[model samples]
Target: MDRKGWVMRAVEALRLATFKEIQRYLDEEGEPFSKKELLDTLKALVAEGLLEEKEGVYRPARKKGSAEAFRRLFGD
Candidate 1:
């Protein structure tokens, strides 16, 4: 039940979330993630190639196709 931070949010966002939605979810949690934290997580995922940056937006990598996709999308 202790869900917060990069690892956890990655999965939720894997379904391809909008920035507002992500920010909103974090806000609903009481202490929302700092902009730095959010940026770092996305940047890290982009580096790993598990995320695709398009038109200034970030989304899950395309065609995951397998369980490994889920793993890459999230889970440390």
Candidate 2:
């Protein structure tokens, strides 16, 4: 998987994670990502409604119909 995929996987596995936690998970998996890269990816994910953030903590947004909406809108 790519870095973004890994990021999503890490967040999904953790359910809720801080920036450092996501970074650590990626590093432990032998895929060290730059801080800017991770943050940028997270920002995009949040914008796409694939993820959510609160007080710098991040989590996958598990809302019904959201995935379908995203696929329709973004053609994922």
Best by lDDT: 2
The lDDT values for all models are 0.63, 0.92
Q: Tell me how many residue pairs clash in candidate 1.
A: 0
Alpha-carbon RMSD, candidate 2: 3.5
Report the C-alpha lDDT of model 2 over 28-75, residue by residue, as the tens digit.
Answer: 989899999999999989998889999999999977687887998999
Model 2 TM-score is 0.82
Q: Give the TM-score of candidate 1.
A: 0.54
The residue-by-residue lDDT of candidate 1 on 1-38, one tens digit each, is 33334434644554666555666766776646777777
Assess candidate 2 and give its lDDT. 0.92
**lDDT computed for candidate 1:** 0.63
What TM-score would each prediction reach against the true structure?
0.54, 0.82
